[model samples]
Target: MRRVIMLRALVWSVLLFVVSFGCAQERDPIVRIQANALSKAFFVGDLKDPTDDPEFYLRATVVDVASGAGSDGLFTNSDAQPTVRVRFEITEDMLLARLTYERID
Candidate 1:
């Protein structure tokens, strides 16, 4: 009896784990954007909820960016590059992302 109960518990545990993992993987879609000097603003519109039962949400993050020499003495002789700032605006119907650049001297 003890062994049978243990087996049933293990099977249910593995089934629960698999179902939760699958649901997590399907929850979000990953998107990547590469920006350059000539890059233009991006917009995504007409997004529809996959299921009305679940709440809808959108998230954005600037993960990494290129760096240049600075007067802080990190790389004095290295070539300088323009610094960029990214801006994001999210609305009910649209998502907008824009980039602006400034020379570091």
Candidate 2:
């Protein structure tokens, strides 16, 4: 009886572990700021659509961009190629953080 219970407990624990691991949340994709959006926003005092070259624009305005989970599906994916979403934030010190850059693929 003891052996049977121990085996059952082990199997249950393994099953639970597998299920939890499988359901684990994946880390968000890395966001590479070709150009800093926050700096541009602060300097320009408005958001400029750098549809022409995001990497260049972002790199220029990359004061400090923060990272957070957000879906890119809300807006059109025409600006950032392969970037389905972007993780970013603007700090009080007027910094733009481009922490994660995700590709649609």
Candidate 3:
């Protein structure tokens, strides 16, 4: 009885550890940028964990610069200087924005 109980506990502990590690690896990348009138063009630079995926899909949200109100869409001149939140995922066919502006960093 004692050996059976210990084996069951060990199996459960291993299962939990494996699940937590898998969850940690599935985290997507989220990039934030300031999209004002002057700085409208931006790009995604080298990611920390680079992938060989050819294309990617992005979800962005724009927040009003003055009142802190936010909406789900691209940046526009309507806001004076808004904050843009971009979250991207690697995909096979979905193509997101192309990086035209060169970033020197």
Q: What is every candidate's alpha-carbon RMSD to the true fold? A: 15.7, 19.2, 15.3
Against the true structure, what is each candidate's TM-score?
A: 0.27, 0.30, 0.30
Local error of candidate 2 at 1, Å? 1.1
lDDT of each: 0.50, 0.52, 0.51
Could you give candidate 1's per-residue lDDT for residues 18-82 as a string of tens digits? Answer: 99988884546665655553222222222343122222233343454358634365443233433
Candidate 1 pairs with clashing backbones: none
Clashes of each: 0, 18, 0
Runs in model 2 with CA error above 4 Å? 27-92, 95-105
**Local accuracy of candidate 2 as per-residue lDDT tens digits, 8-98:** 9999999999999999998999987676444554332335443332332333222333477354652344334432323334445654445
Query: Rank by lDDT, descending?
Result: 2, 3, 1
- Tens-digit lDDT track of model 3 for 3-105: 9999999999999999998888655677564555322112323444434323334334344355665654435544454333333443456525543235466
Alpha carbon deviation, residue 89, candidate 2 (Å): 17
Query: What TM-score should be assigned to candidate 1?
Result: 0.27
What TM-score does model 2 achieve against the real structure?
A: 0.30
